[model samples]
Structure formats: C-alpha cells, structure tokens
Target: MAQKTVLFKHLEQPEIHRLDVYRDAGGYGALRTAVNDLAPAEVTQMVKDSGLRGRGGAGFPTGMKWSFLPKEYDTSYLVCNADESEPGAFKDRELMERNPHQLIEGCLLAAYAIRARHAFIYVRGEYLAIKELLDAAIEQARQAGLVGERIFGKDWGCEVSVYRGAGAYICGEESAMLDSLEGFRGFPRLRPPFPAVRGLYGKPTVVNNVETLANVPHIVANGAEWFKSTGTEKSPGTKICSISGPVNRPGNYELEMGTPFRYLLEDCAGGMAGGKSLKAYIPGGASAPMLPGDCQDVGIDFESYPAAGSTMGSASFILFPEDCCIVFAQLRISEFFSHESCGKCTPCREGSRWLRQMVERIEEGGGREEDLPILLDVTDNMVGKCFCALGDFATSNIVASIRHFRHEYEQHIRERRCPFRPHPAAEPLLQIAGVA
Candidate 1:
C-alpha cells in the first residue's frame, strides 16, 4: 500500500524551495516550536522517541548520535553530509533541491539539541546547483531570523554554512567529510575518538545525511507517535528510495519503511522497463549486496534487509534486468570503487584496485578457474580490515554476485566469453577493452 508522503508532501509545490512557499506549508514551524517550547534535551528525546535513524548508509540512530556530545563541551559542531556520490543515490539531491528549508530547519533543530554553535553542510562539488539553492535558502533564513543570532527571538543562536567538497566519494564518510570541511584531503580517521567524541577541530560533533536531517522538521511538527505510526517500530517513517536501472519509472519514491521490495519495483516504479524481467537488484545502491529477483518478498527497511542477507544502504535501488550480465555489472561497480578509493588504507586502496583488475580480466574473457576463489579471498580480506566503509562497499556487489550467480562466472570461464551481450552503451568500452 502507498503511504502518504511526509518529507515529500510539499515537493510538488512550485517555488517550494523558496521560504515564502515553504513557510506557508508549515516549514520552519518545527524549529520555532522546538526553540520556543521544548528544551534541547526535550527535542533530542522527541527524536529518539520517533525512532528516527540516519538515512545515510550506516542507519545509526539519529537522536543517539546527538546525545553523544559531551555535556560540558566548550564547542560542538553539526556537519550535514550532503555528498550524494553513491553510484545510484540521488534522493538527497532531490530533497535538497525541492525542500531546502526543511533541511535547514532540521539542521537548526539538531544544532539546538547538541548545543552546537555552528553547523556546516559538506556538499559535493558536482551538486553546484544544490549548493546555490541551499546557500540562498540559508541567506533567506538568516534574514528572516530563522537562522543566526537569537533565532525566533530565543536566546539560543546557531549559524549554518555551506562548504562544497572536492568531489571525493570517501568524503561521504563522517570523518572524511570533516577532514574535507577543514580544508584537508578527504580520508577516513581512526575511530578511537569517533566524531561524537572529537570532530571538526577537536570538538564534539554530530554528522547527519541530507535526507536524514530533512526528516527532522516533520518529526518535530507532528508528534513522535504520529511519526512512528507509519513504518515498522524499528524503522519508522517514510524513506525516500531512489530507484534506477531498467525500471519503467526510475526516480525517487517516498514509501513507508517496511514496504515490500515488490511494491517498490512493481507498483511504485512501474516494474522493469522494455518488457524486461528482473534478474537481481542492489537493494541499497552499489555498496549493498544485490538481492536475487525472487527476494521481492523482502521488506525495504533497515531491519528487513539484514534479515534477508542484504542491507538498506542509502535506499538507492539499482535493478538488474534479465539480460543484464552480472559479471559485467560487478566489473563496472568494482571499477568505480577502485577509482574512488582514497588510498588512505592499504586494504581499500590496493584491494579495490586488485578487485577491479580481477573483475575486468574476467569480464573481458580472460578468466581463469582459480579467479573465483581469489576474488572471494580478496573481498574477504578487504571486508573488515579497511579504515572505513568504502572498503566494505567495494566488496559488497562482488561478493553478492558470486554468492547468487557463481554459474555466471563459471560460464564466462568455460566459454571464454561473456554469455550475455553487452548493453549498447557499454559496447564501445567492451570493444576498447578487447572483449570480442
């Protein structure tokens, strides 16, 4: 069943990004209520009660993250992870483009809860237009006293700024994002002092995704019970799923958490395009293990995915059609991870590159029978040994492909060619790689 839109309720409104249109639709009302009536701890408790989790890949509890700040810190910072560079993740981009104020309001409320004096949004350089939109929104909010000194005439004050990243996928990680924001190269930091303990110039910090923060205003405006009433208890509220790859209607669809995977593909996304049958799908972008087509019975939420031997990483679904070549797909995904590896850790830096080479050789019809075990071995080595999740992401698709479709790899080795034809768009690349 299609649940009513919460975060995307006002998405269709023209000029919704503008403060006037947004305010008319109850934007910033939550921040005002939070500031005027509720204490910072009270607001944090409300979010915890709402069961709101981070929409970022990790699915960490948002309120719990806020609560991690030291009670007596001199300075605390809130950083918004706006780097939507995951291969198929565009939900954050759309949310920021359509409902800028909602995110600003979320940031303000979050900062208030953490007692953060300043907040920075680390946006990817590729999202130039989104930066412009958010910058304008921030300026407008400052002028209207929705941001900056004594917001809503309350004694509390918080400033929000937009910092554009240099287009590194690793920056999406909280520690790397802080590094980039601090004018350093994007690289994951050691975890002895997590961001909650020490971040953004040695101050306690809270990092949240764009979509995750965007949900804050709604949770505050409506009561926590109302917010929790929709999705499952553990994964309450609607999720903005970005569906792509061979779907008839590939775009962002806001559905309640725990909605079945079948509902997303068939009902919301209009099923596979061009009369194609589903083969497999990445339940949550390229970093998540792909689920077989028959796993449609699985629910699209945090708890459900892990139970189904997959994950709900960013809720970016990339579907594979019947004619799609799993080996070729894995090769492409491996290449992406390889190119994006920050080289900060030997496991991710070297393992991802080696994985890409192995996948490329197999995809180009140079596979040896020993390659499969080597691939799995490489993936296992990189899984828990990397400095950050990027290394784990590099192995997700490759490992899942081997688990579900090992025969595909065997066929490539046996026949000395890709059993499936390359897509027309990939034909040039395959030819260039000497894959006849």
Candidate 2:
C-alpha cells in the first residue's frame, strides 16, 4: 500500500493544528507554492492528472468538476460542502475538528484553480465548534495574505467565508447547499444546470466535499504522480476508512484504497470487538449495499468495490460480526434512512417508512412468507422513481439484503421467528409482537 496521506502525517504532533506548528510541518507551504509558481489551469490539470474524485458520496472527478465551469463567466464561486449527514460516515467531522487548516488550504487552492473570487465552507449546524476553528483558521490565513484581497502578492485573489447549515441532510447535495448558502430553502433543484456551469447566485460554481478539498494541499505539495502512486491505479490516494460496528477498534483508518479488508480490520483497527467471526459489511456507509463475508478479501477501492457489487461512497466501512443479526441491523439502518429522508420525493418520503414497517414486522416475528414478495415489490417500486439519489440510496440495502440473505428474510417469514435470536435485545418488541 502507498503512504497514508492526511490523517497519519501530523497525527502524533500535539501542536499539529496550531498555526505555528502546522506551518513548521510544511502545511500551508503548498498554498504558497501553488500561488507563487503554478497557474490556475495547471493546478486544475494536475488534480485531473492525479485522478482525484469527489470524496463526497458521488465519486465525480474533482478536476472534471472544475473544468465543467463556463470559461467566460465572470463570477464563479467555490463552496466546500461540509454538511456531512451520511449514516456511519464521520471522516469529514474528524478532518474539520482536528485539521481545519488542511481543509482551508485545500479550499484556497481550489478557489485559485477555479478562479473563484469568493468561496464558502457550508458547515453543518452540529459542527459548531469546528466551524469556529475553521473561521479562526481562515482568519489566520487571511492575516497572512493567504485569503482575502490579492493573496501571495499575485494578480489573482479570492476570499473564503464559512456558513453554517440549519441541520438538513439534503443540503449535502451541491445544488441544495448553494441554495442554503443563498439563504433560501434547502430543497434540491433540478440538475440540468449542474453546479459546474450554473451554480450559486446563477453563476458558475464548484462545490466539493470536505475530505475531497482536504486532499488538495498534499496533492499540490507533492506532485500529482506522488498522489497517484498510492491507492488503486484508477482510484489513487489514501482514503480515511471509517470502520465501525462490532470492531474492537472502531475508528478511522486512513490507508491506501486497495488495502485489504482483513488488514484494515485486524492490523489497523484491532479486529472485531470479541474476536467473533465476521458477518456481512456495508462497505461504504449504510447507503452502499451489504457485502457477504466471502467478499471480505476484495480490495477497498472504487473499481474493486463495484466489482464486488457496491460503490465506494465516502469510505464509511461498517462491519458486522458473525453473531450479529443481519435482519436487526438492516432494520435499524432502514429506520435511520426513513427518519433522515428529506421527504422531497414520494418514493423516498413514503416508501422508506413502508419499508421500515415491513422490516420491523419481520424482525418482531410477525411476518409471513407472502411478505417476501411484497418487500421486493415495494423495493422495486422505489428504484429509479425518486427525486434524488437519497431515495435510491435508501433502498439499496433492502434490495441487496433480499438478493443475498433471502433465506434470513424467509426464516423470519416462514416460522414467524428470527433464526438467529440470541441477541436478546428484542424482548420488549417480542412481548407485544403480533403479525399484521
């Protein structure tokens, strides 16, 4: 595996986040080098060359996103979508809290590359303290002429402002973020005018994920080839793998993309909590479909993950031990998606609730074999019938589960009982369990 880039670099340093400490550790030096030496186009080209995609859920290419901007437009903007509300995804939060300047530096470099005169970091409301830290970092950068006015004594100049979102998951979508930033409602707009050409304030804009922007400084500091040396040939660079659920050491593991799941679980995260045998895994957060234990050997990269039948969405690796009930865990995840759905689309808004209800019924030993087809029918109705990706995302687990674990679902329906009922956490529900 290639070097762990952002997370491991200044991790051990007690004062790594401090302005003086970060500066000494070759932190914002990349920004200085970028502004002084590289042209904006060259920087964008370099990022493209490096094969950096959006660290956000959607794996859109970063430079391609920047290149989508209309060249003749006068007032293009860049906004870092820090409104990370994905279930089981917390990499952005760690980056914001522990390494604000790294993100800030990336934002500045992206702003310069896009020729954005103004930029905004749209942070979620829950990250209040992190926002303050980022603001302070921005101020520090501004005072040093890294932000605001003619930065680094160059003809090009830009300013960055941090805006807080009103705790909406939908705002994580780029267009919705732009809307929220403009002090409007947070519903997703129709996307023919994708954020690249027509974005914030009806001008060209580029919105990037927090972790995606955080990669910029290092990519610029080291050449694109250096960044490409790590990870898979297609998906380069180290990604922060958030390994949670039943793992003994459930935390972020920033490793190269093609790192083995066993290495990530055993060596990096100290294996499962009780040395239990591994069950299924939701490779990239709850949104991505579950992978059976047999596929554990698959490399954790864009190409490999999809080849194993899942997308690399935000690198939120959630593992389940062999003893854990897939039905219960899936039901819980469905409930979460049902709760978080923005209700913009009918399929997601209503279908998620229905799906959760069915799962709940099955979990409580109150389902029938007939319900299996019904569940599939319900899931079938949701596919490609929602407003945003969130709708489809909400249904991915149920679809994948039935495809792989139909017997488990059938066991719930056939005997009106969960085959693996050793959990004992369902006493309350079983007390009132009845089939509908």
Candidate 3:
C-alpha cells in the first residue's frame, strides 16, 4: 500500500470535524469500548502488547510510558503534545484541524487507560483556528456525557482542556509543556522525579505526541494485533510522514512504518519537483541528520533510520534538490535553533549561536580549510550538554551537511563564493575593506 489513510481517511469529509459526523462514522467507539468494557490496567496491557512507540522524537513505548504512573494516585494528567513546532513537522496541526473528534476520542481513551482525570492538548499558539476547533470538540464531548460525570456510566470520568502555548519550540518537550501548562516559563524540569511520578500540578502524568495519541483510538477499537499487522514489527502502527521541500506533492501521508523513502519520494510525493535531482533529504525533522541523495532507500522506521546514521524524529522528511546549497540550508536551520534557544543551558545558548555564525561564514565565502575541524569541535562540545535536546538538535544538520557535502563547503571556500548562487553576500565582502 502506497498510502494507508487511517486517521486521514475521514479528512476529505467536509463535516468530519463535527461530533455528529464523527460518531456516525463510528468515532468515539474506542472510548466507549475502553470506558464501558476494559479496565484501566487491561487498556494499558493492550497498548503494551500492540508495541506502539511514540511518534514524536523519543520513540518510547506508549504503553510502558503509561505504566510509569504511581500505583496509587489521587489525581493525574494526560498531555497531548500538539506543539508541532519542528520545521518540517506539520502533520499534528492538520491532524487536529481535520479530525478533531478522533483526537478527542483518542485523548479520552488514553485518559481512561492511564486513569488521568484531566487531559490537556497543548497546542501551538500559531494555530488559532485549530485551537478553536479542538475547544469546540472538547465541549461537544463534554455535552454528550462522554467527557465528564462517570463517562459511559462507569467510575472513570475524565475531561479534556485545550491549552494554547506561545509557540516555543522548547515547550514541545514534555517537561517544558508541563511547566507551560502550569503557567510557568516553558523550561524543562530536571528528571528523576519524572512526569509519570510528579507531572502537571505536581501529579502523575503521561505526555504523548498528537500522532501517537491519535493512533490509540484505533488500537483500542481494533485489537493490538490488528494494529501491529500493518507496520514493521519493531515499529508497529502507521506513521503520518510529513514530506516537504521540492517534492511534487509535499504533504502528510500516513504510511507503514518500514516503507522506504524512495517510495515516499517517487510515488507518494510525485517525485522531485521542477525536474531537480534529489541532492539530499533530512529523514526526520531538522533534528535528524541529513542523508545523502544516494541513500534514498532508507526505511522510515525507528530502527532503519538509526542504522543509517539518522533518526525518524517526528517522521518529518525534508527533501533537498541539486540546486539547493547544503551549507545555506544548514545555516538557515542553525539560525532557527539559535533563535529558538531558551538560553537555559550554556552549551546550547552559546554553541547554537556559534554554529550558526560558522555556517553563515562558510556560505558567505569566509570559511577556512581549518574551520571544518573547529566546527566539528564546537558541535562536539554541545552534543549531550544541553538542558534539553535543542543543543543536540542544533548540530544534526551542520554535522551531517559537513559529512555528506564537505566537497561543497570546500568548493565555496576554494572559489571564494557559493557555487549555487553566483552573486556573493556583500556585507562580509565590505567588512574586509574597513571603510565604515
């Protein structure tokens, strides 16, 4: 199957966002089944048996994560990480916009599984309209006795709240989102007293990505084995792969986990756009390392990516064409990491800025043969040194671009200008003159 539209199947329906249409199409059946029939422990076991991993960067087992909660908890939270702030990751925003009910139902089922009394969909503030849609859907679920007051006449009663964040990339981190949900500055908390033990409002919590939670309803409605039959054994369930940049059809496509990137680019994405040959592609989001054009057969799974020296972070694949400058692309990405840096850790705060400056210098024809080792050294200092993954993320494209396209950077330095762009950046050229 080229594109398996599980969550996206009903997106074409104009009114599918509405509860009535959603229910008519068998929506909330999972939540109903989960609440009325399965016990919380049973629901958790089913998820564990399904082998569903987080669709976000971490790829942790969803069921095992749910099982982390304290045995006896008075109150807990379930957070849906809808802050789709990664550069190439736009699947979550559309997933919430088009299929709000399914998301709501999934949240409800997750809440039931974890015994969370409250579930919050922490959305990106840029998505004002989608936030309204989720708010309305939550209200709809509430009115139907699906959200509150002994859901399905059982002892479990959970409600969902839509909390819009100010579009901080750091807030996409679970702990940072929890801090934001508690009305604090969006900074990640120190671990050990992890979220499952003391999370939102200082209670146990489970944070999952929009795509990860969206799959829960299907898993619960159909058995775990049914869900497992579709994707790879290691990475069970489908992934909503977001392919952007220079592709004919650069949009989200729900695909089997182990499908190769070649199929996605040639068939699903309608091949490269404007007759440009594929020079490279970042298999995951900007955080994932960019792969060479020749490595197109890389499978889109948790194991396949790491085996190929990259990752499936958010399953956001950003394609690059021959005409595109790898250094320039990495410069733009580094600048983003620098701009979005929360400054909580010195490594990321200083290293990201320095990394951006180095890449910018290389692109503007000020790079040295020695700058290569210096750039690598700087990234070496920053990796695994940040408060969160931001610093580590800042180095992915830079290191990968250097590794795969060292000749390109060398060409820029040797020719004293970017090969792709004939006209050179003038400011750096002017700096040599000292003619202020």
Candidate 4:
C-alpha cells in the first residue's frame, strides 16, 4: 500500500505557512468546532478513541497522558515538546517550520481538551527560525481572535507562548523540560510527581511532542474513527519519519504506522547512497536500538519494533551504509550522550563518559577481549539506576551493537585493527597502547 500523507498534505504549498493560506485550506475550523460544539470531556474521549500515541521516544498513549491531569486544578498547562535535539530526528522541525498554524491549532485543541488556559511550546534554542515562524503565527492567530481572548467568539480562551531551551537533550524528558520551563537548570525530576500531577510551576501540565499534538486538529475536524482508520489499531494515525544518514534522499516522510521499512528505505528514501549494500540501521532515533539491515520486513510501528528487538522511538530512521563502522558509530553516539548528560545522576553522568571511552578505545584498536564484557557490564549498571531515560539511551546503541556485532568488536581485538576499514590513526593509538 502507498504511504498516506496527513500532516504533510499541504506542506508542499510555498505559502502554506502563512495564516491566510492555512485558513483557506480549512485550518482553525476544527478549533471552531471544538470550542463551539464539543465539550472539553468529549474532546478528550475523542482523542482516547483515536488511539493516538506519543511520537516522542516513549510511545505512551496521548489521551491517557491527558487523562492523568487532575480534574480540579486551579491552573493547568499544555506543554508542546519542540526540542528536536535527538540526533537523526528532525520531523518536529519540519512540522513547526512549514505548518506552524497546524501545531498552534493542535495546541489550542489540546489546551481546550485539558481545560488549560495557557500552553507553552518548549522549542530548542537551535530552532530560532521555527520560533520566529511560530511567533508570527501565534500573533496572527491572536489578532484574528483565534487565540487569546474569546477564541472564535467562543467562551473558552487559550494563550499560547513559546519558550526556548538552552539545547539540553535531557530537557526532552518531560520532568526535565518542566524544570527548564520553570527557570531552573534542566534536570530530570523523580517520578510519582509526574508532569500530569505537578508540572510547570507545580500546576498540572500535559507535555506532548510536536508531531503528536499536530494530529489533534485532524482528530477534532474529522472524527476519532477517521483518525483510527489510517494506522494499525494499536498505533493509529500517520507518523512523520525523519530519514537521515547515508541515503540517496534524506528527508522527512509521513506514512501510515504499519508501512514496511523496506518501502521507506527503497521508495521513500531512494535507497542507500553510492549503491552500497545495507549494513545496519537505527529503526528509530539514535536512542533506539540499532537493527540489522535485513530486518526491513519489520513494520514501522510501536508494537512491531519491540517484537523485533528494537523500538519506534521518534520514528527517526538513521540508515548506516555498509562502509560505516559500527564501533565508530557507537563511539560517536556515546560521545553525544556523555556531553548531553545533565549530571543529575552518578550512573548516567559517569557511565556515559566511561562508555564513550570504551567505545573509543575499541574503535582505536586498543580494545582487549574483556572490553566487550566490561562495556556490557557498564551498560547494565546504567540502565535502571539513572534519573531519566538518557542513561538508558546511552546504553541502547552500545548494547545493540555488541549483541548483534560482537564479532566486529572481537575482530578489532584479534586483528588489532578494524578489519572493515583502515583507521589511519589506529596505528598511532596502538603504538601509544604499546600493542604491535
């Protein structure tokens, strides 16, 4: 079956980012219907029925997250996570840049459902262009009475604001984001006081991904059943996948949840670059466990990925060509986590650094046979002991690479060099290690 485009339907239109262009394409009609006709509870129920899950790393059900908010909070907030800092993830950037109004409408609908008077989009600092576009869109909506004051002349009103983060990957986590939004250093808070309970100034808050919230207007404009009709029963609605790394065509492509990975790589991404054969691919973002290239038959959905020993995290498909070294790839990933760790927990802050060192040693041909076991041991210690998922994310690529390509690490030790490709610096590193 051909991939269906939901969020990107009108994305190709050059001026679709403008307010008038968006309105002509039937924008804000859903917000009008939601505000004028449907009750707040009804909107929540509709989203629940749609079976929409978070497009963020954790595939938690979106409606379920909203339902966790207290029914009698004095004030509540809807936070849109626009931090597209995850390596190989850029779908949210495209959505916010091209269809800022769509996201605003989605935020409006979500705010209405949760009865939140104020909504904040915590966009990463790097997305300055997107922030400018969203600022213009929000101002446009405010002037037209679509946002702020009596929206569309209805009783309910919502004030949408944009907050910029200091480019911390940990801020992508909900509690950490709340801490950042509250003018504190970005660090993950302990659970039991989840964001739904106490978030954004100790008031109940609902934090959702940009793509997850972008589906709200469609669900409101059409119906729950309409939204559910597209994707699988468990993972409904279209997902915008950000394809990157060594592909002939690297860009964002929106498709139904159950579409095969083969279609995405071959038809959508135009296959691998330089006629290279497949080696390995990160099924989701860099956080997700990497899968062998032959797993292309695996369906691109939440349930399907885990069954195949991977995850559909953020749907950021990072394809690695055959020439790419897995150990070097993991070393780079480890370096990212090490640099991004908030130092909130000892295991993550220290373990991430150690993991990077281990991978670097292995890549530099200084690894001993015991280094593989040591890497696995360090990953095990870091997985559940950290404050947030960052530690676990740091482990994913290392654990998955070691599991699937243990021989790659072993060959590096036995041959005292990377067998696949010559590392010019490997000789110098081995000389420093007093090997060979």
The lDDT per prediction is: 0.88, 0.82, 0.86, 0.87
Q: State the displacement of the C-alpha of residue 13, model 4, in Å, after optimal TM-score superposition.
A: 2.4
Per-candidate total of colliding backbone pairs = 0, 1, 0, 0
Q: Which one wins by TM-score: 1 or 2?
A: 1
TM-score of each: 0.96, 0.93, 0.95, 0.96
What digit string (tens of lDDT, one per residue) describes model 4 on residues 1-436? 4489889987668688889999999999999998989999889999999999999878899888899998788899999999977887889998988889999999999999999999999999898888888999999999999989788777789999999898888889989999899898988999978889998899999999999999999999999999999988898888888887667788889989999899999999899877887888887777899999899998889999999999999988877667667787777788888998999899999999999998888888899989988999999999989878899999999999998888888988888877767643323322221111
- For candidate 3, the clash count comes to 0
Ranking of all predicted structures according to lDDT, beginning with the best and ending with the worst: 1, 4, 3, 2
What TM-score should be assigned to candidate 2? 0.93
What is the C-alpha local distance difference test score of candidate 3?
0.86
* Deviation (Å) of 142 in candidate 2: 1.8
Error of 1 at 345 (Å): 0.8
Error of 4 at 204 (Å): 0.4
Candidate 1 regions exceeding 4 Å error are: 425-436
**Residue 245 in model 1: shift from native, Å?**
0.9
lDDT of 3 by residue, 355-378 (tens): 989888989999889889999999
Residue lDDT tens for model 1, 1-436: 4555988887679689889999998888999899999999999999999999999988889999888887888899999999988877889988898888989999999999998879999898999998998999999999999889998888889999999988888999889998888888988999969998999999999999988899999889998999899998889899999888777788899999999989988898899877878888888878899989889988888999999989998998877778778898888888889999999899999999999999888888899999999999998899889779899999988989999999999999989888886465334432322222
Error of 2 at 291 (Å): 1.1
Q: Rank candidates, TM-score, best first.
A: 1, 4, 3, 2
